[model samples]
Target chain A: MNPVELKYNKEHEYAGVNGNIVTFGITNHAQESLGDVVFVELPDEGATVTAGKSYGTVESVKAVSDIMASVSGKVVEVNTQVLDAPDLLNSDPYGEGWLIKVEADDLSPLETMMSADEYEAFVATEEH
Target chain B: MIGTKRTPIYEEHQAAKAKLIDFGGWEMPVQYAGVIAEHHAVRNKAGLFDTSHMGEIDVRGKDALAFVQMLITNDASKLHDGKILYSPMCYPTGGIVDDSLVYRYDTEHFFIVVNASNADKDYAWMLEQAKNFEVTVDNVSDQYVQLALQGPLAETILQRITQVDLSKIIYYTFTHGEVDGVPCLISRTGYTGEDGFEVYCAPEFGRQLWRKILEIGASDGVQPIGLGARDTLRFEARLPLYGNELGAEITPLEAGIGFFVKLDKEDFVGKAALQLQKEQGVPRKLVGLEMVGRGIARSHYPLQKDGEEIGFVTSGSFSPTLNKNIALGLIRSDLAVQGDVLDVMIRDKAVQAKIIPSLFYKRG
Candidate 1:
C-alpha cells in the first residue's frame, strides 16, 4: 500500500504536493508494469510542463515509454540519482525514486488527480 | 487481426497472474513476476516456462532419415535414437526458412520442433520434400505441451518429482520417463545458455506436471518464467531467432551457425547454394554489438560507420546480465570485427557502439 499524502494520475504517476513545489515519481504499479528501469531521461530544471503531456522518457529492459506529466508546472529540480541508478524506480518509487520537483503554476490541477484511496480503487479496476 | 493461438497452459498462466502478449499469433505469457526477476530465477535457481507455443511435427515412415536429410541442411543419419540435432531448413537460394531441433526416436521415427510462427510454412515445406520418400508428417503442436525447467538447479529440482535418472540424460539426448505417473519426454536442451531440460507431454498432463514441479521446487526458488525473459536470456546467449537472425533473406552460414550445417551430406534443399557460398565466402555476417554511449539500439535501427549506413540491428535489448545495451546486426564481413566502433542511429541520434563477438554471456 502507498502513503495517503500523495496524489496519483490516471497514467500511474504519483505527485506529492508540499507548498508551491510538488515532487513526483512513478507509482509502484507503474514500475512493476514497466519491468526493470534501465535508464531515465529527466526533464531539465526550469523546463515548463503541461498536464497530460510527455515530460520525459523512461527506458526499461524491454522498451522505452514516455513519462506523462500529471500536473502543469516548471521543473524546479531534477533527480540526478535516478539518472545514475534507474533501478531506484523499482525499489523505492514513492521515495528515493522521485523524478523531479516542479514549481506549480496552479494548485487547482491537484484537485483533478485521484487521492491515495481513489487511486487504489482505480488500480483495482484496471487489474480486473 | 491475426488469430492469437492459445497454448495448453494458457489458463495456468492466467491463474498465476502472468502478463499475456501476442507472440507470433500465440497468446503467450510474456512475464509473471517480471522479466528480470524470472531471468534471475532461471540463472540462479530454476524457472518453469510454458513453451507449448513451439510447433512439434512428427515425421515417421520407412525413409524418415532420408526424408529429413533431404529437407534440412543437417545430416540426420548421424543421429542415433534419443539423440537430437539442430539445423536450419533453408530455401534453394541459400536463405533460411526456419531453424529447428530434430529428435531421432528411431530409424523410421523422428520428431521436429520448429518455431510457432513457421509451423504451417515449415510443415508444408517438409511435406513437399517428403512427397518422393515414404514419410508421413503429422503436426502434433496442439497435441502436446512443452515445459522448460532451466537454470543451475533445474536438474536437482526436477529429479524430486520424476523417477528418471536425469543425470544419465546427457546434453542433446532425451529419455522417456514418468513424472507423477504421467509419461513425458525430457531432454537436456535449453535456450538460456544454462544447463536445463525441456519436458514434452500430453496437454492434459502438462498442467499436472507444471503444478507438481512448482509445488516440489517452490522451496528452492523455482519460478514460472515467461517469453519476455526467454527473449532476453536467448538474446544474451546470442541464440538466433527465426525471423530476426535467420530470415528468408539471411543464410545460416552467414548467421554464424555453420556448425549445424552438414555440408558433406549427400543432398538437402539449400546444399548447392550453401556449398557455393562456402566456397566463395559469405558477403555479410551477423555480429554482436555493445553500446558504448547513451541510447538503446532496437531492431531495424540503422548502423553507420563514419556517417555511412552499413547495416541494421536485428534483435536488441538492455541486457540485465551485462548491465548495458546490446544488439545483434548483420553487417558486411569486413565491418563485422571485434572492437570496431560504429554508430547506431536511435531516434535521430547516433549512439556510439562497439562491435563485439557473439554470445554476451557464457556458462561458467
Candidate 2:
C-alpha cells in the first residue's frame, strides 16, 4: 500500500503536497514493475512541467519508462541522490527516492488523481 | 499469457514468487529476486534455470552423422561420442533456419537442442531435409526437461549431489550421468559467460531435480534465475539470443557467428550461398556498442552515422555486470571497427555510442 496522503496518477507516479510545493516520485508498484533501476533522468529546478506530460525517465535493467507529471507546475527541486544511485527507487521509492518537486499554480488538478486505495485497486486490475 | 504453454517446472517458478511473462509462447519467469540480484548471483556465485522450454530433437540411423553434417554449417565430422558442436542450420539460400547445439551421442545417434520458439519449425526443417537420407528425425522436446546450473560455483554445488566425476566433463563436452538417482545427460556447454553445466533428464524428474539443486546449492549462494537475468548474463558473455541476433532473414555470415561456419567442410545446404558471401564479404557486421549519452539503446533502434540511418540494434541493455549501457547492432560492415562512434536512435534522441570489441566478460 502507498502512503495515504499522496495523490496518485494512473501512470503510477505519486505526488505529496505541502502548501503550493508538491514532491513527486514513482509509486511502489511502478518501481516493482520496473525492477532494478539503472538510471533516472529528471527535470532540473526552474523547469516548467505540464499535467500528464513526461517530466523524466526511469531506466531499469529490462526496460525504460517515463515518469509523468500529475499537475502543471514549475520545478522547485530535484532528488540528485536517486540519480547517482538509481536503485534507490527500488529500495526507498516512497522515501528518499522522491524524484522532483514543483510549485503548482493550481492544485485543483490533484483532486482528479487517485488516492492510495484507488491506486491500489487500479494496480490490482492491471495484474489480472 | 492465456493459453500459452507451461513447462514442467511452472509451479516451482510461482512458488519462488517469480515474475512470469510469455517468452516464445511459454509462460516463463522473467525474474525472481530481481534482475540485478539474479544477474550478480550468476556472475559472482551461481544460478539455476528452468530451461525445459528449450526444445530438443533426436536424429538416429545409419546416416546420422552425414545427415547432421549436411544439416549444419559447422563441421560435424569433428564430433565424436559425447562431444557438443554449436552450429547454425541454414537454408539453401544461406539464411539461417536456427542455431542449435548438436550433441553427438555416436555416429549413429545425435541430439539437437534449439530455441523454444523455433522448436516446431526446426523439426519440420529437419524432417524436410531428412527425406534424402536414411535417418529418423524425432521431436523429443516433450520427453526431456533441461536445467542449467551456471556460474563459478556450479560444479562445486552440483558435485555434492551427483556421483559423476565433474572434472572429466570438459567444455563443449557432455556425458550421460546420474543425479539424485535420476538418469541425466550432463553437458558442459553453457550459454552464460561462466563455468557451468546443463542437465537433461526425463520430465517426471524435473521438479525433483530443480528442487534438489536449489536445496543443495543454497549454502553456495545459488538462486533460481529467470529469463531476465538469463538474457543479461548471456548478453554480457556476447552470446546471441535467436530472435534478436538471428532469424530466417539473417545469414550466419552477417550475424557474426561465421566462425561456426565450416567453409572447408563438404557441401551442405547453405554451402554455395555462404561461400559466395564469404568471398564477396558479408553485407553487414554485428558489432558491440557502448552508450556514451544518457539513454539506453534497445532492440530495433536505428543506428545512424553522420545523420544517415545505416542499420539497427539487435540487442541492447544496461549491463548489470559491467555497470554500463551496451548494445549489439548489425550495421554496414565498412563502418564496424574498434573506436568508431555511431548514433543510436533512442526514442526522439540520437545518442552517441562507440563501437567496441565484442568481448564483454570472461570467467577467470
Candidate 3:
C-alpha cells in the first residue's frame, strides 16, 4: 500500500514534506516494475532541478530508466548510502532508499501532486 | 501489433510466469525468476532452455557433402558422421549471411541450423545455391524442437534418463538416444561456456521432454532459463551474436571468428574475398572492455579514442558472475590491443573503459 502521508507524481516518484524541505524517491510500484536495481546515477548536492525534468538514471540488470524530479528546487543533500548499495531501493524504497532532499522554492507545487488514494487508483488501472 | 510466432514451449514459459518479449519476431521468454538468478544457476548448477525457435534445414542427396562444402566457408569433407562443424555461411562479397552449424548425419545427409531471424533468408539462399549442385535443400524448421541443458551438472542429470552412453559422446559429437521413452538426437553441444547437451526431438514431444528434465533435475535446482541469461552466458564466452557481431556488412575476419573460416580449402563462396581481406588485414576487430566508470556500456554505444569516435559496442552488460560492467566492442584493429584506455559514450557523457580479452569467462 502507498503511504497515506506522502504525495505521488504520475512518473512514479513520491514526495514527503518536512518544513520547507521535500524528500524525493521512486515509488514502490516503480522499483518493482524495474526489477533488481544494479546501478543508480544521482545529481550532486546544490544542483538546480526543475519539476518534471529528468535528473538521473536508475539501472537494473535488464533495463535503464530516467528518474524525473517531482518538485523543483536546489538539491540540498543526497543519500550516499543508497548510492553505494542500490538494492536498498528494492528492499526499503520509502525509508533509507530516499534519493534526494530538495529545499523547495515554494510550497504550492505539492498541491498539484496526487494524494495517496488517487495514486493507488492510478496504479491499479495501470496494472490492468 | 505485428503477429509474433510462438514456439512449442510457449505455454511452458507462460505457466512459469516468465516475462515474455519479442525476439526475432518470436514471442519468447526473456526471464522467469530473474536474469541474474538464472545466469548463476546455469554457471553453478544446471539450467534448461527452449531453443525451438532456432531453424533447422535439411540437405540430403547423393551430392550433399560436395554441395555443402561449396556453400559454407568451412570444409565439410573433413566432417565424419555424427559430428558437427561450426562455420559462417557467407555471401560472395565476404559478408556473413549467417553463422550456422553443419551436422553431418552421414555422407548423403546434413542438418544445418541457422538463427531464427535469418531462417527464411537462409533457406532461400540455400535453395539458390543448390541450383548449381545436385542436392535438395529443405526447410524443415517446424518439424523439430530443440532444448539445451547446460552447466557443470548437466551430464549427471541427463545420465539418469538417457539410455545412450553419455560418457562416450565427446564434444561436438551426437548420438541417437532415448530419454524417458522419447527418442531424440542428443548432441554434446551448447552456446553457454559449459559442459552441456542439445537434444533435438519432434514437436509433439517437446512439452513432455521439457517437464521430465526439469522434474529430474529439480534436486540440483535446475531452473528454466530464458533468452535474457542465454545472451549473457554466450556473450561472456565470446560467442558472436548474429545481428550484433556478424551481419550483412560484417565479415567473419572482423568478427574475430576467422578461425572458423577455412580459406585453405580449395573453394568456398567467400573464399576469394576472405583471401583478399586476409592479405590486406581487416580494418576493425572485436575486443572486450571493462568499465572504469559508473555507467553500463550497452549495444551501439560509440567508442572514442582521443575524443574521436573509433567504433561501437556490439554486446555489453553487468556480468552476473563477475559482478562488474563489461562489453564487447568492434573497434579499429590497431587500437583493439588490451590495456588501451578508451571512452565509451553512454548517452551524453563518455565513460572510461579499458580494453581486455574478449573471453570474459571460461570454465576450468
State which candidate has the highest DockQ. 2
The 0-to-1 C-alpha lDDT of every candidate, in the order given, reads 0.90, 0.92, 0.92
**Local accuracy of candidate 3 as per-residue lDDT tens digits, B106-179:** 98999999999999999999999899777999999999899999999999999999878899999998889798
In lDDT terms, how accurate is model 2? 0.92
Q: For the second chain of model 2, what is the TM-score against the true structure's chain B?
A: 0.99
TM-scores across all candidates?
A: 0.92, 0.97, 0.97
Q: Residue pairs in steric clash, candidate 2?
A: none
The complex in candidate 2 yields a DockQ of 0.80
DockQ scores of the candidates: 0.63, 0.80, 0.62
Instruction: Report the C-alpha displacement of residue B129, candidate 2, in angstroms.
Output: 1.0
What is the TM-score, restricted to chain A, for candidate 1?
Answer: 0.96
| lDDT, residue A104, candidate 2 | 94
Off by over 4 Å in 2: none
Docking class for candidate 3: medium
Q: Which candidate is the best by TM-score?
A: 2
Cα lDDT for residue B234, candidate 3? 94
Share of real interface contacts recovered by each model? 0.67, 0.73, 0.33
Off by over 4 Å in 3: none
